[model samples]
Target: MALMITDECINCDVCEPECPNDAISMGAEIYVIDPGKCTECVGHFDEPQCIQVCPVECIPKNPEHLESPEQLMQKYHALVTAKNDA
Candidate 1:
């Protein structure tokens, strides 16, 4: 599943850089996670890098954007391809 930044995010700016896919960003109120770009670090790590580094533990699985591991891997491949193309 894609991950999400909850309201508990402290905006410490730690999670943004940890995301391999550049899926995390500062929003109007707090840090936000882009489900479209979020592969939960499937292509880059055995675990989600943002979740590991978030001091506030605000990052959680996005129930709204639920996805299986296979789906996430597919998204990761797509992201890599797109990035390489650019």
Candidate 2:
């Protein structure tokens, strides 16, 4: 499943760099996760890298964009392929 940054985010700027998928970006108020690019670090790490570095624990699963592990792996492969092609 993709993860989201809640309103509780302190704008700490830590999670943005930790996201292996480059899904996290500075929003109007806080860091936001792009569900289309988020794979919960399935292709890179065992755990969500953003959650691991977020001090306030604001990152949580995105209910609206839920996907199974197999789906996540597919997405991860797509992302890698897209990057390689560029």
Model number with the top TM-score: 2
lDDT of 2 by residue, 50-75 (tens): 88888888888999998999999999
Off by over 4 Å in 1: none
Q: How many clashes does each candidate structure show, in the order listed?
A: 0, 0
For candidate 1, write residues 1-86 as lDDT tens digits.
89999999889988899889999999999999999999999979999999899998999899999899999999999999999999
Give the C-alpha lDDT of model 1.
0.93
Residue 55 CA displacement from its true place in model 2, Å: 0.8
Each model's lDDT comes to: 0.93, 0.93
Residue 1 of model 2: what lDDT?
A: 80
Per-residue error for 86 in candidate 1, Å, reads: 0.9
TM-score of each: 0.97, 0.98
